[model samples]
Target: MTTSTERAGSGLDDGPLTIGGRDFESRLIVGTGKYPDNETMVEAIRASGSEMVTVAVRRVDLDRSSEEGILHHLDPDEFFLLANTAGCYTAEDAVRYARLARAAGFNEWIKLEVIGDEKTLLPDVQATLEAARILVDEGFKVMAYTNDDLVAALRLEDAGCVSVMPLASPIGSGLGLVNPYYIREIKDRLEVPVIVDAGVGTASDACATMEQGVDGVLMNTAIAAADEPVSMARAMRLGVQAGRLAYLAGRMPRREIAVPSSPVGGMLD
Candidate 1:
């Protein structure tokens, strides 16, 4: 049996291992939150071709733990399980939850998000940075979920996070990149990988983020809420490829005049 220990960084290394020794194959990470059902979520995952999926770790209901429908639906081996401390309010709480997740079946890869404010769903940078630093020191590969604040992003990167996952818009807003330039700047300045984490509405939004040189995109609402999730998933896959290809291909400069090649007057003559 291929245990999580043996496969620690196996599939993840298909692409780049950004930080803290965790690797990822595809540049896209899909979140398992906000989907309509288990089947649809599974379909979306298959369509997206995403190797990593985010799973939130809350207090498992002691009474109904065995009957938790959603938990059972997820196949641990199919996707790289990135357990997140979504409901945590403090650094200590987040760290404890991460430990708990590790104790459970989930791996050491954690999406460290400490959001005390429910309205904005924005991360508490102070607490987030503290938690991230501690998590990194404790040997967990921290993928810090943060706001689009470049300063905070840099702080998280400096704190030894595996990757900085900044929100494209507010969580579940689906408004796409409110300020793409900031994300672009982060990609430009930071040494570690930057993944656009939330609020992307369509495939174009994902492409836009990738075009800005972001290492990857993490989306939930955009695909989950789509009228046809499978179709959306396919779109996202193509969009990611298009964006990556464009980035690598490099665009040509704008020209004021067209240079004629095959004898401009030959056709008329």
Candidate 2:
């Protein structure tokens, strides 16, 4: 009798999430921000059961010896450290950051973000596409973070991105899955993995996002800002797995009218 805990991160259910020839058991990728402390961040990350932990490259110094840097606290052998161009506002800025980050990390994988506006924090898709092409040309595996637009997603993939990340909502809004149709449409249209990033508010949010049949979900504030981050991380783990499983199970069709269960033609008859 295998309990859910035993099977949670076992890689037995969801299988490996492959990005640019790298394999990951967990689909719940997380960020290294908004935690109260380094210890809490580490514990929450472990509890989340994510194989890859993404750090905002723009926010931290890549020098591993820097005690203040998040990399100093993380062991590369244990967790795959993914660098993201978090705050860069233009393709040039993101490309520069990506080059610097990869030089230090000795890896070409980068989560590219080129924010369009300070107020909404939505991505500048044009800049993101430009960065993706540049990074791809430089032999980097770019995972682009963009809005939920099918055309934009297709363009990113065409630009040679390894993965396309669509926001569930604005960053840190905790809005949950606001547009499942667009997400599903994007997933259906793209050959690359579609990871739903940002805007997941809770366990149910993560679950709902995954149930839309996207490859995975990446989140930060949802877990880090929780009153009990570790607990929330654990819940998010369950949520992601459950959602993936539910999607695999193939949900029953939706109906406009109620259908009775157990043959409702007078129970005694």
Candidate 3:
């Protein structure tokens, strides 16, 4: 229940991550999918220390009373539910799912995704932008998922999306930050929060992604597919905190030649 700062103490206290006017103590956001069972998923989520969790409207069992339903397992009062358009391939379909979640009285925040390809699982920039526009017009806090490109990120921010989510690699690839430069560029250029979503294979990936100075990271497969999901989840929480702290501390300038720690004029021998 404690935040990264609370657990790490004053030195690591970077403060809460704010998205769409809501402040979450944890900067790591996680997805609810790919676990063997709901119990494991809940335990893993709790371990990750994430306050906001994503749910694909198409996949959730809407009957809140059902034991197997995500709603039953993840208490809405405990975690902020972010509805997403996971499987939708078209702008209209993505919009439909977003609207469906809203009609069901779920939260208005959306993790908008219009998948362009089935094999690659890349997002369709055009469809994603179109869907974001519609969702924003409808008063939904849209968090668009797109490839790591500054132009697309800028467009999404201009389209009134609450946050811009750029993939570290193709969805579920676990490639672990293929293009950190692009993520940095997107973060440097955008006004809204930038969250690196997908392509994180392990704790190091989450750490590396945060080192780019992004606002946060969103991942699923990295934790869910791990052999020890609960343990991996805890590791990821620490990784995110470590990376953020390292970034804030700042790294020394990269140099081609090595510098002696002791004064060069003084000889120990």
lDDT of each: 0.83, 0.91, 0.91
User: Rank order by TM-score, top first?
Assistant: 3, 2, 1
Clashing residue pairs, backbone N/CA/C < 3 A, model 2: none
TM-scores of the models, in the order given? 0.85, 0.92, 0.92
Give the alpha carbon lDDT tens digit for every residue of 68-116 in model 1: 6456897888888888898888999999999988888667889999995
Give the lDDT of residue 196 in candidate 3: 96
Off by over 4 Å in 1: 1-22, 62-65, 69-71, 253-269
Q: After superposition, how far is residue 35 of candidate 1 from its true place, in Å?
A: 2.0
Give the per-residue lDDT of model 3 (tens digit) for 1-269.
77875656643557778888999888899999999889999999999999999987755458654566688789988899988899999999999999988876867888999999999999999999999998899999999999998999999999999999999998889999999999999999999999999999999999999999999999999999999999999999998988888888787899999998878876767
Between 1 and 3, whose TM-score is larger? 3
Going through the candidates in the order shown, the clash numbers are 3, 0, 0
Top of the candidates by TM-score = 3
Per-model C-alpha RMSD: 6.6, 3.2, 3.4
